[model samples]
Target chain A: MRAFVRALPWIGPALVLIALVVLFPIGVMIGNSTRDISQSGVDRGGVGLANYAEVFAFPYFWPIVGRTLVWVVVVVVLTVVISLALAQLLDKAFPGRRLVRMAVVVPWAASVVMTTLVVHYGLEPYFGIINAFLVDTGIISRPEGFGWTRNPGTAFAWAIVVAVFVSLPFTTYTILAGLQTVPGETLEAARIDGAGPLRAYFGVVLPQLRSALAVAVLINVINVFNSLPILRVMTGSIPGYDADTVMTMIFKYMQNQHRIDLASALSVVAFGLVVAIVGVYLRVVRPLEEA
Target chain B: MRHTRRASGIIAITLATTTGLTACGFGGGTDEGDGGEGTTLDLLVPSYSDATQANWEGVIAGFEEANPEITVNLEVESWDNLESVIATKIQGGQAPDIYNGGPFAGFAADELLYPVEDVTSDATYADFQESFLSNAEVDGVAYGLPFIASARALFVNDALLAQAGAEVPTTWDGLLESAKKVSALGGGIAGYGMPLGSEEAQAEAAVWLWGGGGSFGDADAITIDTPENLAGAEFIQKMVTEGATQADAGSTDRSPLMDIFIQGQIGMQVGLPPTVGQIEENNPELEYSIHPIPTQDGSPFTLGVADHLMAFENDGDKQEAITAFFDYFYTSDVYVPWVQAEGFLPTTKSGAEVLGDEESLAPFLAVLPDAQFYPSTNPSWSTADSAFKALFGQLATGKTAADVLTEIQSQVDAG
Candidate 1:
């Protein structure tokens, strides 16, 4: 009891900081969600779940939510898988390995908005290098013209491409660290035991790097879910299939339309989704702690 | 180490609290100067390049010289996403005293703008051109001062037109025929180009509809589904399909269109007067002439856009100073140079008369009588724009004009 009392002072300061910075703002958001936001400052009213109901009732709400989920899953999965492959390939000592590493990190270092603008203007119909090359090669009979990001399917595809590109460097570095930690002696032993490269990778290296993989997956999941800039700059906040991640939708409601209450509600919903995903992740990975 | 950490934490907390308190203090304090002997006015204007800056500074210097008691601080903000930034500042009660209140004033009027009814006088308001004044008036009160106005005109590559043996089109059918001739000459340019992307597309599309005697709304209700509007939409669709414009017409913005026109890739484009200056700067050899937007029924109609200067609700002395500054702004010394720098039509009758005498500026001034203001005052115009853009995008791809118009009308009505 005395020891507990002695530790309370240090813990109290940390708790206060967390409560003020995080919990208080969340409480305020919840309180705001219950009020009506007319021209006047937040109307004090007792409306239980009405804002949530309005959000659900809107025709665009469900489709946007569904699209956000698909966006996060696709971006997270592709980024992790491709980055893992690249990290493994680059983990070995090879010619120009340092240059390849630098090349991989360059996109991450550059501003995402600048990158999107380059892509947008570079792919523009009249002056874009893509069209110029296509014309030169005679692959296209006529100019495919513009509108690459105009269609929903192509827009969504481009969004995933951008997300993956921006995410690759960090994910690759994380997985590369994991690859280094997998004991070389164990791999040599597996090779002497008649296991091929792919077999050794699956049986020996994979299990060893599970913790690093967990961290990479979790980081990518949170990042892809919260990412706003790539989608925003690329598609201009169109609320479905490309620019309608949960974070972007919440921001659009708050800033573009000035619907702070609905934005708060959407934010709370997004927060809940993120928390649930993290919770499941922790639970699933709990058994691997001993490793 | 423990003591150091504790001290660092204290410093962080103190810094945060100080910042928060200072922000709160600024918000709560009166933005308008007290009726003291000396007052400072914070004026927000859109950012400009060095030449435009020098011109504005010259005006500011003259204003300051005239009113030594009042000091003006110029804050130049970028135009992109500026509306939302202004809204946030106003909502937070830290907006500048005199800010750029352009086309977004309608949005501001809906609980955003501080009412300026008391600050402005009839005599002061009378100094502006009637069309400019009327455009700034919202709900029967002048909440803004009309500063600059721009109009869209058809820019023709005279060499290309003469080479193709075509005259400048005055009507819709004539334009189509000219377009066909220009396309056949193989200059890698379209005969016409309009920004079909989002809000701009909807706005440009509306000009054609209105020129053809169609209406989107009639003060109280949606009216865009009429046959005339459909015919206008169909004409745009035909232009895209027939290669009179590029298939990518839905995505081309003003910049790309201007680039192609400047490069002599396109024979004709609908652009503003500023484009003429740009063409002159980029390619002085390109022979181009400006004319009014072609009408469907052989009448002239052009799209005119205006910027407004507004006075927020403030102290009496600040109001007087604002009024004086605006009076100084309208004088030929300040107004003429500004018009030339911005490449916009002058807001004063005298200034417009002066610009009309210049041969290069005459075409833009000539079309002023036919210019129509944007037909919307809705706060949700941005939303409407995107919806309209989507419909037009579908139409440009291949949807029937009638179906798109019906769908758009329904959507606007529902919203």
Candidate 2:
């Protein structure tokens, strides 16, 4: 009883914050999803799993779910790999390393919307520099420019590209910081044991960077999954086209279609997916720590 | 370490609570100030353009001169996300005194809008055109005051037509023939361009179906799968299959299609009266003429829609002010200048007279009599719109029109 009373003051604030911030919104979202929300207001009816049923019944929903998964996986893997490579390249004592490091962080500093618009307009068929070069270099027989947004494959690829581009700077910087903390003596010991640069990197450097890599990967996954503006601005939330992201779909349903209940339901589903992904990640990484 | 942990826990709880409360308070505030019985009237219209906003201000000045006691607070919202913004405001109990919006009556009938009966009277209703008045009526209750009207029309580039030696198509057959002739020019130019992207696309596509004597939903049941609607779908499919339109039409929205039209890459395109203004701005020397959307014979009528000025039922003072402002807005001096500057057909009979005198707007006004409003009187018109869009998107992507229509009909019926 004395120990409990002693901890009450600190525990009260933590409980209040959790209840208000995380639990309360989740509760509201769950409640909203079960009702028929429209332009008028929420219709407080017992729509037991009906919104979820509709989401499942819709043919486009699964494809979007599949696409989102692919989007997250591709984006996370590409971001981590590219960022790690950049971090390694910058880690070497090279000329203009400071300038290169600054350049690396520029993409992270640029607004996602600004970068998307630049990419969108810059890839225009008639006037875009990309197409202009392709045509000028006789890369193709026709002037039919690459429809980065219109084609589904290319759209997915570009979405991944944008995700990686936005995520690269921060992840790279973090990995670089992680590399700096790794003792030089470990690499020296690997080199003395006749390990090549590649072998030493794989056995020593990567293992040392595991914690940073895990954090980077986890953050990248969440950030990419939550990203709305790039896809929303580029695709305008048209279903079955470029709008495959869960956030964009939610925005479309709630704002464009006025189907708040369905949006909320989808949001809950998204939240569950995120939680499950994190759980699986933690479970998988547990063994790595003990090793 | 224990002290640090305790402090962090407190901070986290406070942060969480604040965030939760903030999210919950998004759309729950009530409007405190009434318009106060005196004379200041608030008019909320979606922002269209800088020039139009200026014109609205000028009209308010003119209105004030005529009725010195009345003042208009012209609040303009952008079209993008305007519906949600309005919905949020209205739901939050802070609805504007007088707001103009497209498709408000249907929303009102669905219980999304507040009733405006106290502000409107039978005498005031009698002054509007029958079609205009009918567009704002739901379940025999007139919920909105019609302000401005627009209809879809075909904007034809005469130079492209001349180059192809094609005449203006008045029928679906004629349109198809002309489309082929223009596409044969072989310079990346298309015969026609219509939005096939989403709901707006569906609406534009439905013009042909409706013109061909097709009806989507009846009084008690949905009928999207009728023969006429299928024929209309097939007509669009034929255009796509025959190489008249670009294969990308299924994915392109109005803006890019408009861009294509402006770049002289499309021979004919369907656009509102504003396209004339856009053409004038983009290429002053462009040879383009406005004509009625090509029909499937039998005196084809263009699809017309209107934006309505409505009042909420919460505050009496605001309602009275809104009523006064609506009355002022329809009057000749203010409404005429607004119609002329904004390039939309006026709603009132007298207001139409003013629009007839403007050379650029005359063509749109001329087709007003031949315009057909959306026929559904159901409050769930937005749902119908979604079903229609889904159906039309499938059709545009080469799905069997009959199957898509059947699916849409079933969904609408179920809804």
Candidate 3:
């Protein structure tokens, strides 16, 4: 109390500024979500829950939500699982392990958009290196590259691949941080108790990794849910909303479509949806961390 | 003590965020007359290609030389994402002094742009191609000077057409038939190229809609579901079915058509005159001709596209600098070379006539008088463009045209 009271003068000004900076935009977004966005994009007047109702009624609304959930689930789970395997391998003493660790972190250092562009070229039908390799090995019949982002299925597949690829390094590093804290004696005890490496890892190190895995998976969920640039650059929303997640769809609505009210309403709901899910996720996973 | 520490941590984070955000606020404040030098006009332009950006920078240099006191800060953004970029800037109250874009009706309605009459002279109006000038205006007031005007034309690969023994189709039915024949040659040749990628897909589809006597609706209302529009939509679907366009056109970008056209694999595509530069760069000897997009009854109309130079009011010398820069930039010495470099038809009547007989410019220039813009000057048009692309993409990807049109009409009418 003394510390807080003594700091009031400096903190008051900062607190006020922080409120203005952070809360102000959120307040405006909430306000606009309920306003009728006129044809000219001005707020005509209040429309109650009209905008929310409209977003809910959008034909692709639920489908986009379903896809977003699927995308978030897959990206988060795969990132954790892949990173866990890599982190386990990276944790052990190996020749040139420092070089391998540096290589593992390289993707995290590179720009997401630049890497996405490289991924785009790799999947392009006409001149994709991936297509050339596949054809050269007689993996597929056609000489012309297979149209990767042309359909929703392939686009979604490639989007997940790129998402997992970019997500790998950060997740691996996080889990690696957790790995360092695990006492070597605990793992040795498990091994001495007549457990193999897989059994010891599964029952001991994996459970102990709860906090780091939770942090990684939670962040990835939020990131993949809101990620727009990768799918936007890769797919160009070719099939429009069909290839976009809810966040990207919201971007299309606000930016390209200029449907401000609809975008705002969608944003508010999306924010709430994510918050609620995270809350539930944390509640369910809290026990493991506590253990 | 733990609770106090947690509260302190929260305050620390909030304070840091506040400081960071407040710092970002510094550079965007209104300049109260940078009373040091003359003035600096922030000119934002949509760069069509690398050459276009170079031409813009060159024009800015000439303007700076002519008006030594005033400095023009030239910023170029790609056309693909410029609209959204500008929208965000405007909403954030950080709009530039001058912007190059389409006649956005929303901007006009919101009065985001100053009326072009602020800088345009009678001679300026007389010199500019009337069609380009008129379309850039809303409610009797124009926003910007049209610096780049591109009228879409049916660019035919003469070699491929000759090899396939097909004449240039001047009518809608004939186009389908000829495209089918050329596609039959089939060494990865597409008879027609349909772009279903990005916001530009909606623009390209408008050409076909125009040829079928359909409108995206008048200034007052949206009638995108007109029978004529359905006819146009059906025709596009038919081309896909007949193997005249790519199987995965809905997923393909404009690069494929441009690439194949350069390689003599694409027979026909509705393209701008600037494709001459692309062709020359790729394969200079590839024979091609630019003609008007064919109509149902062999009538003539082409989609007239443009990039307008608009000003946003920032008060005082900034406004003055924008007007002054426009006047200097449009002069023949600066304008002509910019036009020659960009390869688009010169937006001005004087510039057009001066280059009227250039062998490459003649065909596109000949059709300047009859070009039509999409009824999309309205700000909501872009939003409608998304719906158009989605529904149109579905149609191209094998959805029913009538069903797609119904959805488009629903989205627009509701808008």
Candidate 2 stretches greater than 4 Å from native: A1-21, A125-129, A140-146, A237-243, A287-291, B1-44, B52-75, B110-117, B121-123, B218-222, B315-317, B388-391, B410-415
Which lDDT tens digits does candidate 3 get at residues B1-415?
7545643553343333322311221234444344576887777788777777778777777778888888777778887657656765665566778888774677777777778777655566567776777777776677767877788788999988899999999998889888998988865677887776654677667877778888887566767888988888888888888778865876666766577677777899887777877888889888988878888888988887787778887553466676677777777777877888778878886777677778877778777677877665665565577677655677777788898788878887677
TM-score of chain A of each: 0.87, 0.89, 0.93
Per-chain TM-score of chain A in candidate 1 equals 0.87
Task: Evaluate candidate 3 and give its CAPRI docking class based on DockQ.
Answer: acceptable
Lowest lDDT 10-mer window, candidate 3 chain A?
A282-291
Model 3 Cα lDDT, one tens digit per residue, A54-123: 8998888989899888988888888888999999899999999999999998888999999988988887
Error of 1 at A95 (Å): 4.8
Interface DockQ of candidate 3 = 0.41
Compared with the true structure, the alpha-carbon lDDT of candidate 3 equals 0.75
DockQ of 1: 0.17
Best-matching candidate per DockQ: 3
lDDT of 2 by residue, B353-390 (tens): 65567787777777778877665455555556666653
Tens-digit lDDT string for candidate 1 (A1-291): 999899999898987976765556566677767766532132446577887887777666777888888988899889988988999889989999999989999988999888887776655666777667776788755554445555556666787888899899999999899898988899999999999988998999988888788768777777777777777665652222234667766766654445556776776777667666655766776523546
TM-score of each prediction: 0.85, 0.89, 0.90
Which residue runs does candidate 1 get wrong by more than 4 Å?
A: A1-54, A143-147, A237-262, A276-291, B1-37, B48-55, B104-117, B120-123, B163-167, B184-188, B218-228, B314-317, B376-392, B398-415
